[model samples]
Target: MIISRISRFISNFDNLLALFAGACAVLAVLFVLFLPLPYSEDQLYPKEIDESSPLYPYERGGTPFERADIHVQYPENSPFAGYVTAYLTPFSLALSRLTPHAGTTIVAHPGGILDEILYNTRGLDTVVETTILFIAFAIGSYLFRKGS
Candidate 1:
């Protein structure tokens, strides 16, 4: 029966090792999902710009209304900047709507070092998943080797 086969597999040392490996894979996934990234908003968006920057038109001999009208364009640094903006904008909007009083500004910035960091962090979700898969494979390999 299937139960007998499973029981035999579980009783084997190699199978136990494989099971432990599989458990590690599962744990890694859970950790990544629940893990708080060791980064903060301030750290991610460093004090690169100041009130004195030309981008802040108020500092450049402009009226408050004129400054408000001045729109700083996204610098042409990377091709994917647009895509990242497109994706995060709506997500930020939804977050803002969900928490009306949260007071989170969700503006998209074009490519810079910060942009790259954001992209990498956003993309790291896949890396976390892949790492789990690799761990599982490694454990499985060890178990198979022991069995052999």
Candidate 2:
């Protein structure tokens, strides 16, 4: 009886949070649609990503997705699967160039970026994110269980 009451409280809280989120979404849409705001205009017509920005070398004729100056030589039998995988997910190559060459070590490095992403982030950000996901999944499973 106590367990059932506790579950009911938690389930009610979860439902309230969901409804609050939905209401916020609707409010945001209505606000954007009805109100006249300066910054919101940018959302409607975004500034064209400045091609001539020194970060991305500008070319008169260049591939839409690719930069001009930075030449990417595709490696044979790379960590990536093949040509299609490499093209679809160019992150491997991009990370190589973008990542800092030095000052990355904290005395003892644990493997690669995967470990860093899994472990290191802004303090409790990962913990909070994981908690939220876990709660959501638990609530969803409880609500969508086989019999009831």
Worst 10 residues of 1 by lDDT: 63-72
Give per-residue CA lDDT, model 1, range 56-89, as digits (tens).
2112222221211111233344334333322334
TM-score each candidate: 0.24, 0.25
Question: Candidate 1 at 121: error in angstroms?
Answer: 9.6
Give the clash total for candidate 2: 0
Poorly placed runs, candidate 2 (over 4 Å): 1-91, 94-123, 146-148
Clashing pairs in 2: none
lDDT of 2 by residue, 1-148 (tens): 9999767866887677877888999999999899885563424112233344322221122232432222123323222212221121234334334543321331113322223223432225778889999999999998899568
Clashes of each: 0, 0
> Relative to the unseen true structure, what is the C-alpha lDDT of residue 19 in candidate 1, on a scale of 0 to 100?
97
